[model samples]
Target: MSETTWPWGAGTATGIGSLPGTDVAEAQRIVLGELPDLPHLPELPDRGPGADLIGRTGGLLVELPVELYAARWRIAPRPGKDLRRARDLMERDLDQLAEQAEEYAGPVKVQAAGPFTLAASLELPIGGRLLRDPGAVRDLAGSLGEGLRGHVAAVDRRLPHATVLLQLDEPSLPAVLAGRVPTESGFGTHRAVESEVARALLHGVIEAAGVPTVVHCCAADVPLELIRTAGAVGVALDLALVTDLDPLGEAIDAGLGLLAGAAPALPPPAGRAPTSAQVADRVRRVWDQLGFSRRRLAEQVVVTPACGLAGADPAYVRAVLAACRDAGRRLAEE
Candidate 1:
């Protein structure tokens, strides 16, 4: 856990997805200048297609893309070389990011798409169905776990000065397990049981990363209990979509950290960017509803926007992160 109770921070996403043409160092400094409490590393998605914000979080699965669909994932194994070219590319990026993160003095978070989401997004070659083969899913999970261990180490090596937090982005988990993934012809889907096998797959990756991990799902009806059971130290969710806080309340009591998305990711109608006082007020309201005192609230909460600011204007994105930091500070002091 961070020394501060309410460790305010924003997601890796910023207005400009990637830091390509602009100065990466300047971009990170600009973000830190606004929120010094819990500044996460910036994700520069403009780098390329493979470097998409969701894929570059250092938790990529090797060989699964081909297993899913040789033509679709565009994966190929180059011969005569022990390591693949993509792995080399990853190491280069990691080296640069680690060197750049030296300017920030707080813990930095690295984000990645979780296993379920990956399986759903990718496709199978023959029929276009994603790893429907149980064997394929297991292979993907193990490979991802192996990859994450190395990725974590690489980040730590690059930014030894900062505490690295791994964030598993799993917006598709619930739907996938419910067998909601549409068939190629939109006629069929598979329904996975909640506790039986789904939980174990999620748990394996968390255990492999072996670092302080946080699971983030911007969708509504977040499975709070399952996430906590997956051994995640923290869970980030959109407060607006949360219809039930009972499970979250229990998770909090058990010491699971909460990155509560208080403000909307989209621009507000015309109000000033929510102030620390105003944000704290909202926290107070939520706490009162949950029957938890303000003191306890600080220990279990982290103020943030309802979701990533990827779609928001650049100016609004910066403002949101700044607002979140201020709110967290105010609540912590209270």
Candidate 2:
């Protein structure tokens, strides 16, 4: 298979809802069977709340368990080293990746919570408040960076032939920096004076990950400059929520790969999957709105759902994944 200069592919996550313990190999088979050239591993979400997609992946933060525990984000000390357990879990995941490597013949992605989200999710033990403490935030970021580096190396060792893409999920970034994340009492939010503080910490992780990075955010107001400044090669965003395209257009023109959310994350209308023509039309519409030529579309974009399918109905989830693959094909042919 010839490698395109940009990432022209599909987003990953298990069918929005799937039965528990859906074999990783089966999920990989399902994706590759439908879209052979660009399949990514699926994230099974039935693993319980703590085992939810982000939580499962974000377990990398286990490296900061003591710090996190002190902050009240996690329960008091257990009997073991949380970081070691996390590494073991990650290794197991990498082993699964190795098993599915034959199916995913293109870029292989592994996503985890970004630094900002971790900071927000972790509570400080002192006041049982989130690690919104500026100094603590920095500590969390460094720990995340170090943990991510170890993760990348593990994946490389396990799946040596694949081009690894580390995806940083940062849904809390804008809210964290803008003070939109409300306090426990819900009366107000804490604002970070230097948004750059968070940005720089995230940037450090991206740099340290030692692989091409994509910062994914399903929320509004994705900070284009911050993402680019972090040295990310791609940005995955929910297309339905894009109100402003100017900055995105500039970024696309600047050679960033876009995992365009062309397909809806929810199930399509009824038992019907969205047809190729409909998806092609949506892609065309978005590009036309940007005033970009059709010929350049393939080089700049990959089709995906607006976000992970963790909350959708199971049948609909499968349909959406199939729809996204078909949509990418239809758009490419168009």
Candidate 3:
């Protein structure tokens, strides 16, 4: 593990990027209020097309431009309406943050689709998914790196006192590694990307991001070793979905921080929501199972929801964020 200062400091609790609703102002206010320790710039996918992950991230590329075609994001020769719409949405969100976070001084986060996930999702200029061509994938990663550099710069320009953390969302990584991504025609699967190449590209992006980087993959089989190899200081994953502990134990022992998604993002079936004790209990169980000391939990682990709360209703989102904040406090007390 890298022995650098963590941007979130201790007892940090945060959300996984996207929040529910289209009102950027309300989302920013709630996130900043609830997750004061490690608030993230909210992503409102409900804004439709360009606000979704692929199209949203595609807007950040330095020279690369993409357009929505045939229900997929495809490379375009020049910036088009779709690209402009995405950038406009992002800029407006940044403005909302700047307005809402006045005089605030704490760690803030911004997320972008990581390289492999982007490659797996984006279509090449020639029609195939970018993952099909290794050279094209490399080029895309480089472009994304540059794009992310600009993204971080933009966030810094807004939240000047905020120690910004970069979260690289890689939900499709496991599918990419397993060669399960659909081919152009949607009938076949692409060949699995080599782990070495994948790790190297991730490393490049982490370096380019120029902030304390965290790799978030809410997949059951999170590649902890690969994430560590890629120079990510933290590994963010859904603790409940994880069945094995050997690799996680090893990573924690190696000093890699865990952005443990211990709380549920979705709403409850009954009247009351999950208590902070319940959330802390889940994390405590995992720590005990890993044979880790309880005292180090607060500093080494950050409490968060299982994943993005984009699909949840506004009320549920607020409750979940508040629960996460309480969970972090409970973990510290534990």
TM-scores for all predictions: 0.83, 0.85, 0.96
lDDT of 3 by residue, 1-334 (tens): 2344566766678999998788889899899889989999889898998899999999998788999998799889999999999999999988888898856798888988999899998988788989999998988999999999999988888888787889999999999988899997889999998888889999998898888899999899888899998899899999888988999999988878899998777776774557877888888889989887776787888889999999888888888788888888887876
Per-residue lDDT of 14-104 in model 1, one digit per residue for the tens?
Answer: 1112232334565566565665656565555544444554345322564443321232342223221212333444565566566656555
Task: Estimate the lDDT of model 3.
Answer: 0.87
Clashes of each: 6, 6, 0
Highest lDDT among the candidates is held by which one? 3
Q: What digit string (tens of lDDT, one per residue) describes model 2 on residues 46-161? A: 54333443345446653455323432334234424543444454455567767767334466667788877776776665554454577877777777788778877776777666
Error of 3 at 17 (Å): 1.3
Residue pairs in collision within model 1: 17-45, 18-44, 18-45, 68-123, 68-124, 179-190
Candidate 2 RMSD to the real structure: 3.9
Instruction: For candidate 3, give the lDDT of residue 171.
Output: 95
For model 3, the stretches where C-alpha displacement exceeds 4 angstroms are 1-4
* Cα displacement (Å) at residue 211, model 2: 0.7
Error of 3 at 1 (Å): 8.7
The local lDDT score (0 to 100) that residue 166 gets in candidate 3 is 90
